[model samples]
Target chain A: MSQDQKRDAIIEAALKRFAHFGVAKTTMSEIGADLAISKASLYYYFPDKINLYAAVLLHIIHEAEQAYGPLVDQEPDPFKAMDALLKHRTEFIIKYYNVISFIRSKHDIPEELKPVFGSVHASELSRMRKMVEKGVASGRFRVADVADMGSLLFECLEGLRMMYLEQASSFFPTPEQFHNLLKREQQLSQIFFNGLTV
Target chain B: MSQDQKRDAIIEAALKRFAHFGVAKTTMSEIGADLAISKASLYYYFPDKINLYAAVLLHIIHEAEQAYGPLVDQEPDPFKAMDALLKHRTEFIIKYYNVISFIRSKHDIPEELKPVFGSVHASELSRMRKMVEKGVASGRFRVADVADMGSLLFECLEGLRMMYLEQASSFFPTPEQFHNLLKREQQLSQIFFNGLTV
Candidate 1:
């Protein structure tokens, strides 16, 4: 196998393990055993556990960006791009919430991984901001401030996702949980549309 | 001091300790020492660390109810009461987010504490639902599904609070820090008013 291919395989395996077992419990040896590689061979690619862990993180961030990277070409109507972006983000959150959580939770990410994540998520943030700003420029969005309005809209969705994660216990009182959540999402969307429509 | 007074004192100390230091690092001996009571005396009040921990949790729940409990009163024209309730909840979250986290992270809280938190939060939930229902009935709220509307509203606020708490590294974006939050609150209120208005 090619060296980078083998490394990427290990990174993917380690991410799945980290997602299920969390960082503390997932052993480097276990990651190697899963790949049918010896611990020594794994160490040859990545120097230590933290290095391997960061590789897993960078891999996910890379994958997430590939899945829903920021808008660059969707300029004629940014809202269309935004609509697609929101849907893309929602799907990513649902499928990779663990990866999302891992990214969200820590400040200890290695410097090597930060540029990748910062560039991707930060670009996505600005891309969405620009889309809102564009709508405002064209007399579409009517909010008092474009950035505040955009942040509020994004946080509303991210907040719902965070609540869903935190209230995974039965304590989450929503009836027909999916229906209830979707209804909430629509309501927030409706409110935004109402407040922001020009 | 009377037995109840001393017991309540101990519970209060334990909760403060738990809130800041978390459950793992919090020691029974430390709680006892904080109260200036002997370990034997502490045991007399509660059988084990778990029991004392539960007692501490229940006390906080009781305080939470005391702090935000009255908004659920059955009365005509409860909008004022609800506004007060939401404001109280906002303050509660701001001041006690850590305490909430402490209680929330526990998997097996004492039986006594469970109902205290569940019933109180459930009552608050019902009150939120009730406020929307009452608003709708009185033609003061939007004509949407009252419960879903209420969940959406709370989820937005809750989501913001949780995000602020979870992503402490990232600051909320703007002059609307407090204003924009209040703005969203106002927007939700406006929607409710529109939905319920004749």
Candidate 2:
């Protein structure tokens, strides 16, 4: 296998272990053993566990970008683009909530990895801004400030996501129920968007 | 002093100490000492520190309700009422973020106090619903579901509040910058309300 392929293999193995046992307990040797590689090889690829963990997060982010990036960029209708983006975001959160929760609880996360989160957020914000700009260019949205409106819309979506995560047990007891909650939230967003467009 | 006055005095003293030293470190004895009361007297009013802490949170909630209740109930314009409520909420958060942060970090908070948070949230949600209903009735809002829209609006405000609290030190490094951020948020809400009313 190529060197890059070996590294990707290691990250894929680490992601599963980290998800199952969590970051605190997952070790380099276990990952190395899973890949039938030496610990030295693993160290060569990622000097420490933190670097591996960050790579796992970045991997998820890249997957999301690949999946949703085109929808934001190529959609003809800005509203539809935003709706797709929000739905994609919700799915991403549900799929990786465990990793997200781990990240939230881990205070010792490296500062270098902090920018990954910020960059992801900035990327999303810029996408929303582009959608707003598209809406205005097409005379579909009456937003006075595309950047501010985009940021607000993104923040509102984030707020809904946070509320859902926080109250998942009580408010959304099952997967179907959670899906319904997301649908309702999306409808609510639709109404807000309609208000903007009108 | 009247019984209610004494309880208020105790809550005030506890709030100060809780703000200064946090819930884990603040003791009933110290609070009683500050108020020139016996530990037993403190216990008479509040069975434990957790109970006392709950009272402190409840006191803050009550003060907020008293301050903003009229605006929600008596305002002639639904949009204006919501605007006022959102602005008031931002101020309340800025004023008491330290206490809110302490409460958020205290995992061992009593179950009884959990309802305090719920009640505050529910009260706010209900107020938002009323405003939406009023707007719909007055032909000022084009909402299909008042409750859902109201819930969404409240969630957006909450999300903004959470973002502000989390990023206060970074995105909003100074008070002036934070205030500007809030103002921009308010304008975003205004655009949303305009969209609804139109």
Candidate 3:
């Protein structure tokens, strides 16, 4: 394989190991063994485990951003666009449950990952801003403070998304529980959207 | 002191110790010592540590119910009543942060405390129902499902209240963080209340 292809192969193998065993438990040698690469060869591509972990996270974030960007940017109806975005977010969170949990295990995000995470946050907020601005322009939303409204709506939806995670007996929610969460989100958002109407 | 008054004193003493040290660490002997009573005397009023813990929790719950019951029932304006109730709730949660954290440590609430907790839940939901029903009757609010809307609004406010607790670096919020939480609640509620209006 070419150098770039080898690096991609290593990242793909590391992602599964990191996701399953967590960062602390998963060793670099195991990751190398999974890819049939020598430890020295793995070290050539990434200097350390933290760097490999970052690569895996970046891979996940890039995939999600690619999926989310078009959904938020392209939808004609602002409310529909937001609904779609939130729905996709719910899936993304669940798909990356272990990875997210590992990141959240610490009180703060790691220094190395902060910039990437911050950029993701900034872009999400901007997308939210765009959708609300669209709504206001269309005369569909009568918002007093567009920025505050957009973020408050985001917070409210985020809270709904986290409800199951905090309250459930299991580490992850059952399918039925996930359905209930989305149902509650829909119900709450209907009232919230109505409040924003002209 | 009379028997009932002495029982009350013991509960009062236990509350402070339990709130500060948690139920597991706060011994029955220490609680009795706080009140200048013998361990036998303390057990005369309550059977064991669990029983005393229950009594202490009941005492706190009763005090909160008394404080909250009037605010929800007597306020003429539904939105104002809810606002007042939520503000009071934020204070209550902060004050009992440790106690509540202890309760949440368990996957399910202890079987012994379930009835009392259930009653409190039932009353809170009923009060919410009453406030929305009053709004609907007065034509101040427009709601399709009164029961569902009241609970949904309650959940939304609850989510906002928990925002600081879940995100804070410290176990309990600092004063400034507390202020910000209430501020965000007011902002979010304004939009939510508007959605419910005629």
Candidate 4:
């Protein structure tokens, strides 16, 4: 494999280990072994565990963007695009809540790594902004500050994610319960969009 | 003082101590001493520290309801009432985030005491339901399930509280920063209300 391909392999392997065993317990050797590479070779790509973890998070973001990017581009209705985006985002969150919670609890993530997470959030906000702008342009949505409306919608979704994570232990113990919660969230998005459109 | 008056004093004193020093640190004796009552007498009203803590929480809920009840009832516009309610709630959460966070992390709050918290949340949801129904009745809002929309709004506020607490250390280090967050939350509520109203 080429150098870049090897690095990508390392990240892919590390992500699975980290997700399964959590960050603290997952060792570089295990990640390297999964890729049939030496620990030294892994270090050549990532330098340290934190770097590898950040890379894994970035990879997750890239994957999510890839999944939703086409839907955002092709959906003619802005509201429907938003609904798809939020549903996709929530599904991703539910699937990865354990890893996400672990990362959130760990305060040791480097300041430099923050932008990796921030950029993903920024990208999501920009998508929402574009949707609102499109709705306005098409005379479907009211004329308001596109940025503020986009942000409002983004915060609502953030709130939903936070609530879901908080209640995951007790309120949403069953998959059926979680599925119901998502349905309610979809209904909420519809109401919010209805309020925006003429 | 009358027996009821004495019990009220104990609850009031306990709330102050609990709010200031947190539940684990506050002692029943200190609460009694603050009220110049015997520890036995204090226990007469609240059998244990847990009971006293629960009572204090109930008191806070009652105080909040009293503060906002008039506004919810007297406001002519349902959207305005919701805005007032959310703003009031966010302000309360900001003031009590530390206390609330403490209670949440402990996770030992008794099952019986669950009703105290649940009732407050239910009351808030019911208020939101009433507002949505009012808006729809007046042709101000699009027809939607009132209960679901109310719960959605309530969840959004709950999410805001969670996010604020999570970001308190980094995103909101100063009172001014927290104030700006509240202002942004208010703006979001306005947009949400605008979407609901015709």
Candidate 2 lDDT for residue B102: 57
In candidate 1, which residue ranges exceed 4 Å CA deviation? A1-82, A91-121, A138-140, A169-187, B1-42, B48-68, B71-82, B90-116, B169-198
For residue A39, what is the lDDT in candidate 2?
A: 88
Model 4 per-residue lDDT at B173: 33
Task: Show model 2 residue runs off by greater than 4 Å.
Answer: A12-34, A91-113, A169-181, B1-5, B12-36, B47-50, B91-112, B169-181
TM-score of candidate 1's chain B against its reference? 0.64
Candidate 2 deviation (Cα RMSD):
4.2
What is candidate 3's lDDT per residue for A123-161, written digit by digit as tens?
766776777787888889988788987788767766665
Q: Fnat per model, in the order given?
A: 0.52, 0.63, 0.63, 0.65
Pairs of residues at least 3 apart in sequence or in different chains that clash in candidate 1: B141-B192, B141-B195, B141-B196, B142-B192, B142-B195, B142-B196, B143-B195
Better of 1 and 2 by lDDT: 2
lDDT of 3: 0.76
User: Which 10 residues in a row give candidate 2 chain A its minimum summed lDDT?
Assistant: A168-177
Put down candidate 2 lDDT per residue, B57-164, tens digits, no spaces: 888878988998787688868868767876787687667755655544223345878888778878878887887788888887888778887877777676666555
Number of the predicted model whose lDDT against the real structure is largest: 3
Against the unseen true structure, what C-alpha lDDT does each candidate score? Answer: 0.64, 0.74, 0.76, 0.73
lDDT of 4 by residue, B1-198 (tens): 999899889988987887788777888999999988897888889999878777777888788889988887677687678668767866776676545545543134577578887888788778867877777777887755777776777787667655655566433334454576677666655566676776
Q: Is the docking of candidate 1 incorrect, acceptable, medium or high quality?
A: acceptable
lDDT of 2 by residue, A3-57 (tens): 9999899989998887777777888999999999998889999999888888999
Error of 4 at B176 (Å): 5.3
Question: What is the Cα-based lDDT of residue A167 in candidate 2?
Answer: 60
TM-score, chain B, model 2, is 0.79
Local error of candidate 1 at B1, Å? 10
Candidate 3 vs candidate 4: the TM-score winner is: 3
- lDDT of residue A105 for candidate 3: 24
Tell me which of candidates 1 and 2 scores higher on DockQ: 2
